[model samples]
Structures are given as C-alpha cells and as structure tokens.
Target: MHWITTTHIAVTWMLVGLIWVVQILVYPQFSRVAARDFPEYHFAHCFRIALIVVPQMFVEAATAVWLLHEGIRATPFLISAGLILVVWLSTAVFQAPTHIRLMRKFDASLIHHVTLTNWIRTLAWTARGFLVSFALS
Candidate 1:
C-alpha cells in the first residue's frame, strides 16, 4: 500500500478511537463536573481536547481527499470520503454548538444533546475507519 493510504488509515483509526473516548468517557463525565465550576471546566475541556482532535481530523480529511485526487476511484474510497463529510458537518453543526452552550453552565439537556448527537460522529468515523482499513488492504 502507498504512504498516503497508510497515513489515511492511521489517522482515520486515530479519529475513530478519539471519538469513542469522547463519547464514552469525556462527554458523560461532563455531568459530573460541578455546576459552578463547569464554565471554566468546559472552556478548558474544549481548548485541551481541540489540541488533540483538530489536527487528527485535518490529517484524516486531507489525506482522504488526497487519495481521491490521486485517482483511487473505488466505491469504498468515495464512501469513506462521504462519511468524513458527514462527520465534519455533524461536528460543526451539532456538536460544536452544544459544547459552546455547555460552556455557559452545565445544562443537563445540553449535555445530553452533546452526548447523543455525538453518536453521529462516533459512528461515522468508525465506518470511515473500517472502510479505509479495507481500502488499505
């Protein structure tokens, strides 16, 4: 397999793993943060998690596009790219706003929304990762 494919698979799995952590551990933990302390906690959470998440997402998306650009026009590659788009859009439209709202205070509804809506991303990235893994093979 080519290096681009290798990078794509690696980054996709990284993102898949990260989303699961955020979904299972981090988001659920938000409920446990004290209400008074939550604003600071949420801000810190966003800032720190961004440090880990953003670059991996960027590399995954860019490398997927690069693979498509290089003429790997298979169903799986196209499907993986499409899933990446869904993951990005869900994060932007749904997840980010929920987190921003969460920063104000720990609203249980907002926390629930963030936790639930994140399934879109978590599952999407997993599918993308699985698809890309096959593409690597």
Candidate 2:
C-alpha cells in the first residue's frame, strides 16, 4: 500500500471516531446546557471544532483526490471518494446552516435537526473508514 493510502486511512478513521463522539456525546449534550450559557457554549463549540475538523477535512479531501489522481480507480476508492462528497454535501446543505441557527439562539428544533442530519456525516465517515481499511487489505 502507498503512503498516501495509509495517510488516507488514518485520517478517515480519525474522522470516523470523531464523528461518532460528536454524534453520541457532544450533540446530545447541547440541550443540557443552561439556556443562558448556550450561545457562548455553542459559539465556542463551533469555533473550536472548526479549528480541529476543517483542516483534517481538507487533508482528507486532498488525499482522496490525490489517490484518484494516482490512478486508483478501484471500486473501494470510488466509493470512499463518493462518501466523502456525501459528508461534505451533508455538512454544507444541512449541518452548517443548522449550527448557525443554533448559534443565534438555542432552538430545540434546530438542535434536533443538527443531530438528525449529522448522521449523514457519521455514517458516511464510518463507511469510508471501512472502505479504506478494506482497500488496505
């Protein structure tokens, strides 16, 4: 396996684990925050998470595209790339706007929307982890 593939797998699994943590632990706790504190907390969460995830996401995307450029046209590679697109589209189309709304005020509906739509990323990244790992094998 090439080093690019190894890097891709490592990053994908890292995202997979992080997304699950967000899904299971972080997002669920949003409602638990005191209403007065929710905006500050949500702002901090958005800022801090962006600092961590945005760079990793860019790296993951670049690596995936690099793999394709390197002539890896196998089914696993294509599927993994497609899944990455799904995650991005889900984030842009659903999650990010919902987070912006939550930032202004803690709307329970938006919270639910974010949590519900985030499954798109969580599942996509999880499947990506499997696809890359299987490609490694």
Candidate 3:
C-alpha cells in the first residue's frame, strides 16, 4: 500500500478508537459534572478535544480525497470515503451545535442527545476501520 493509504488507515483507526471512548466513556459522564463547574469543564473539554480531533480529521479527510484522486475506485475505498462523509456530516449537522449548547449550559436532555447522536460517528468510524482494512486486503 502507498504511504498515504497507510497514513489514512492509521488516522482513521485512531479516530475510530477516540470516538468510541468519547461515546461510551466521556459523553456518558458529562451529566455527572457539577452544575457550577459544567460550563468550565465543557469549555476545556471542547478546547482540548478540538486540539487533538481537528487535525486528525483534516488528515483523514485529505487522505481519503487523495486516494480517490489516485484512482482507487474499488468498492472498499468508495465505501470508506462515504463513511468518512457520514462522520463529517453527522459532526456538523448534529454534534457540533449540540456541543455549543452544552458550553452555554448543562441540560440533561442535551447531554443525552449528544450521547445518543454520537452513535452516528461511532458506528461510521467503526465501519470505516473495517472497510479500510478490507481496502488493504
């Protein structure tokens, strides 16, 4: 496999692991944060996670586009690209705004919504991880 493909695979799997942790462990625990502390904690969480997640997301997306440009028209590659799109769209359409609301105030319903909606990313990345492995094979 090409180096770009390897990098893509690595970044993709890293995101897969990260999303699962966020979904299962991190988000679920948000409601437990003390009311007075929630805003500060949410703000810090956004800043720190953005530092890690944004760059990796960019790299993963760039490599996916590069693979398509390089003539990787195989089903696995195409499906993986589609899954990447799903993750991005879900983040933009659902997750990001929800996080913004959380930053303003801790609503138990919003916490639940984020936790529930995050399955879109969690499952997409999980499927992408498997699809990329198939692409390699």
Candidate 4:
C-alpha cells in the first residue's frame, strides 16, 4: 500500500511538472505564434486550455490530499499545498479578471498580461512538484 501511494504521488508530481513546463515554455510560444499567424484559432485554443486546467486542478488537489494522508510528511506537504492555494488565490484575484477583460476586449495587451502573470502559477506548481518528490523520497 505504501509503495502504491508513493508511486501515485511521484506520478502526480511528474504530471504537475509537465503541466508547468507546457504552460510556461510551450503554451506561451504557441499562443504567440497562433495570435500572429492564426488569429481565428487563438480564442479556441485559450478556451481549450482553460477547460483542461479547471479539472486538472481538482485532480491535483485530490491527489495531494491522498499523498499527505498516506504518510507524506506534514511540513513539506502543507507548504506545497499552501503554495498551491496561493496560486489559486492569485489567479482569482489577478489573472481571472484579466482573462475576463481580454475575452471582452480581445486585446493583445491583456493576453500578454495574462501570460506574464501565469508565471506565478507555474512557479507554485513547480515548487509543489519538488516538495512532493522530496517527501516521497
């Protein structure tokens, strides 16, 4: 059981890491290119990303709790969870409104801001991934 739990934790951490890399490195470049060369596809791509993100967050939260309950240490897990909470708060407070406004205005400036602010989320997830890996080890 412990091995199974550890495996799940490690896999979930890897998933989070992959998501962050895609969000930070790949998605921005894709967005920029799409906006430049395929304006019509930009909004759809953004919408798809948003749709995927919402469910992934729920999965991450659930898995984090499971790992913690399965004997992952409190300090690192809680710290990582706290960081995740902060990222969500920042998204709600800063990024969501920007996205909403961008959806309304279709302004490139708003997109840039949203992408830039996304770094907060990326960093938080990356930190969480590291913590999980460490805790599992």
Candidate 4 residue lDDT tens string, 4-42 = 456546655655776676566854664455334544454
Candidate 1 residue lDDT tens string, 89-135:
99899999988888888799999998999999999999988888876
Models 1 onward score TM values of 0.97, 0.97, 0.97, 0.71
What's the lDDT for residue 13 in model 4?
67
Tens-digit lDDT track of model 2 for 1-137:
78888889898898999999999999999999988889999999999999989999999999998988998888987999999999999999999999988888888888889999999999999999999888765
- CA lDDT for candidate 4: 0.67
Pairs of colliding residues, candidate 3: none
Regions of model 2 farther than 4 Å from truth: none
Better of 1 and 3 by lDDT: 3
Residue 119, model 3: Cα distance from true site in angstroms: 0.1
Error of 1 at 15 (Å): 0.5
- Name the runs in model 3 displaced over 4 angstroms: none
What C-alpha lDDT values do all the predictions have?
Answer: 0.89, 0.92, 0.93, 0.67
Q: Judge candidate 2 at residue 84 and give its lDDT.
A: 90
Query: Weakest 10 consecutive residues, lDDT, candidate 1?
Result: 128-137
Runs off by more than 4 Å, candidate 1: none
Residue 11 alpha-carbon offset, candidate 4, angstroms: 6.0
